[model samples]
Target: MNGAVVEARNLTKRYRDVLALDDVSIRLSADRIYGLLGRNGAGKTTLMSVLTAQAFATSGDALVFGEEAYENDRVLSRVCFIRESQKYPDDFTAFHAFKAARLLFRNWDQAFAERLIGDFGLPVKRRIKKLSRGQLSAVGVIIGLASRAELTFFDEPYLGLDAVARQLFYDRLLEDFTDSPRTVVLSSHLIDEVANLLDHVIVIDQGRILIDAESDALRGSAATVVGPAPKVNEFVTGMKVLHREALGPLASVTVDETLSAAQRTGAARLGLEVAPVSLQQLVIRKTLINHPSRRVPGGDAELDSMEATR
Candidate 1:
């Protein structure tokens, strides 16, 4: 509590020939929400695994509350990791699973869990194996929110949930976060969907840190300028252009720098439209243009097309 809630130093993990994580280092504080973002197989899961002690780091250190995380009950008991494919015993029902979670998590809030169950309309008596994928996701979401651990990680906990259910999860998360602040890390492919909720954004590509900055700073980090083709081209000549679109006499160019005050005024005078880049668009442009191969840390195949789009 006096220092970083979680810290990783040169954390590395290898699976045979593949390096799932490679010399990754990060420090996370308590009472903040962190967005753990990356395309599929970008080592997001592997990183989380090592941090939570679910898996060991190949050649680095992971400390939770200043102590090694692996098999450390003091740290593990205060952390809750809700995975997308969380499994419950075949004979257990949703209620039974909730009961088990309540017992495991020292900070579990029974009333909050009950309310989440009601909000998600989860069937308490239905066997875990009988629930649909979305329903199963709802169970994970419920536990993640109700656990109220000092540090909680939600790794795509709403994978099969519909838009409405997903929205509900976001709403509940935001509301609860405001009321009871804690360290929360959300790992998801729905970048745009959760962009607004994130206070900090961490982008990983090919097992490397691409960008880690305040959400607002990232939003204004770049801007797109649109104007007549020749004018736009000339204006962006010396700047780092992330993307471009041209149509006859019109062209739009996205650059990796904020325009200076004079430059902004000049663009306005020249009848050019300037707009801040969205987090999703910025991330897409960076991953696609900067690292086209999109390999993970160790030579994993590129993330699928759908993941790239996210």
Candidate 2:
């Protein structure tokens, strides 16, 4: 929160028949990890591209390090952008990639890179084309971590890595970040996995910024209460309900507001089960509420319609 490392004001991007980004404004502070979350085609990649100077926005401005990022060596050198599908020369190997990164990034650490190579069990001699998808992803993850850039953007860095490898990446990232605090913006579909790693969260939906808030503030912001339909309905009567469903006589309702200690006790008295909503659940609820077309066959819309009749 000391100063904004990245800032976009009323940003908009359109591609002929498609509107990729729409009037989005956001700011990223230094020395913090931000979770840039959204479903596929939600404009996450488009926004990152615009900010990194890889893609031009049809309208508005994208500023990095207090200046436009395009063609600015001073700015770009201090930043690292790792894409989900990073391509390399067919003849090149992980060794060549690391060697090139060392020269390009001023803050690149060879020792750190070597350690990460070992940690990921990456084969340096194997040609880039000969490596598996998981191994290729490992190369990118290693570079992103070892680059030690002042600002880093990891757009789905854990693409083909298995569960253990993904967790390893998270562990290594958190450990390294704690030692050398820098700004990191991670865009991943696995919300719950990275939820704890984020200091701030930004959720995009349909080219719009649906959520931009401190991560801690979002915890306990919503709760799910389960009980008989009548009791559940009465308990959530004056609250902002994000989602609700009925299974025969039992109704489970998710309210957007937090519950106090007394309120929790009151729910228990009514035999209502109160559960904390995870980050994933909250994001899903919000996204579905915003985009009706993206819902499943028997999703929120149908459930709400059924509730209306009751």
The number of the candidate with the highest lDDT is 2
Stretches of candidate 1 off by over 4 Å are 292-310
- Which pairs clash in model 1? none
Worst 10 residues of 2 by lDDT: 300-309
Model 2 Cα lDDT, one tens digit per residue, 1-310: 5699999999999999898999999999999999999999999999989999999999999889999999999999999999888889889999999999999899999999999899889999999999999999999999999999999999999988999999999999999999999999999999999999999999999899999999999999999999999999888876767888889999999988879999999999999999999999999999887776655468755655555446
Clashing pairs in 2: none
Whole-model lDDT values for every prediction: 0.86, 0.92
Candidate 1 Cα lDDT to native: 0.86
What are the TM-scores, per candidate, against the unseen true structure? 0.92, 0.94
Model 1: per-residue Cα lDDT at residue 30? 79
